[model samples]
Structure formats: structure tokens, C-alpha cells
Target: MQSNHDGKKPGLPEIVEILAVSVCFTYISGGEAVGAVGLLIAYATLRWGRS
Candidate 1:
């Protein structure tokens, strides 16, 4: 069986989850600050780790 790894280096579904969470949090937070920060981090990670 292929072992599933859920580490810091997450996969596609994990990234999608993060994005969804970020969107929801940003929506609830009611400001650009939290959303912007979350989005920036996500984008940076996606870009830097584009393997």
C-alpha cells in the first residue's frame, strides 16, 4: 500500500483546503489585512514550491 504523508509539504487537496479556509477566514474577518496576508503566503508557497 502507498503510505499517505500529511506533512508540511502538503499536496493538491491540502492546498485547496488551505485556499478555501483562507477565503472563508478572509470573508469572516471583514478586512483586507488577514486575507491579504493569507493569500500572500499561499501564493508565495505555491510559486516557490512549484515542483
Candidate 2:
């Protein structure tokens, strides 16, 4: 199965948005230290990838 079956699409960064939101939500909903760290890492990844 090819990764792109539809038209052109934004790839990894767009997918990371979902992960980032998930991490943030987990952190907000009482997730522990690991979850918080995940959230922080998500932000850093997004920022780093954007630039």
C-alpha cells in the first residue's frame, strides 16, 4: 500500500500535530511525569521541525 493514495498531503509534521495534542491532553488529564515529559518533547519537536 502506497503512503499516498489521495492527493498531495502534508506529511510528518501534520501527523505530529495529532501526537502533540494527544500528549498535551494526557498531561492535562492527570497523566504523570512521563506524560508531562512527553508533552514537553512534543512542543520541542514541533518548534524544532518548524524552523
The model with the greatest lDDT is 1
lDDT of 1 by residue, 1-51 (tens): 433553357678767876776776677668576676777577656754543
lDDT of each: 0.64, 0.63
lDDT of 2 at 27: 66
Badly placed stretches (over 4 Å) of model 2 are 1-10, 32-51
| Cα-based lDDT at residue 13, candidate 2 | 62
Task: Report how far residue 30 has shifted in candidate 1, in Å.
Answer: 0.2
lDDT of 1 at 1: 42
TM-score of each: 0.50, 0.37
Over the stretch 1-51, how does candidate 2's per-residue lDDT look in tens digits? 345525445478656866677677676959876777677666656644433
Worst 10 residues of 2 by lDDT: 1-10
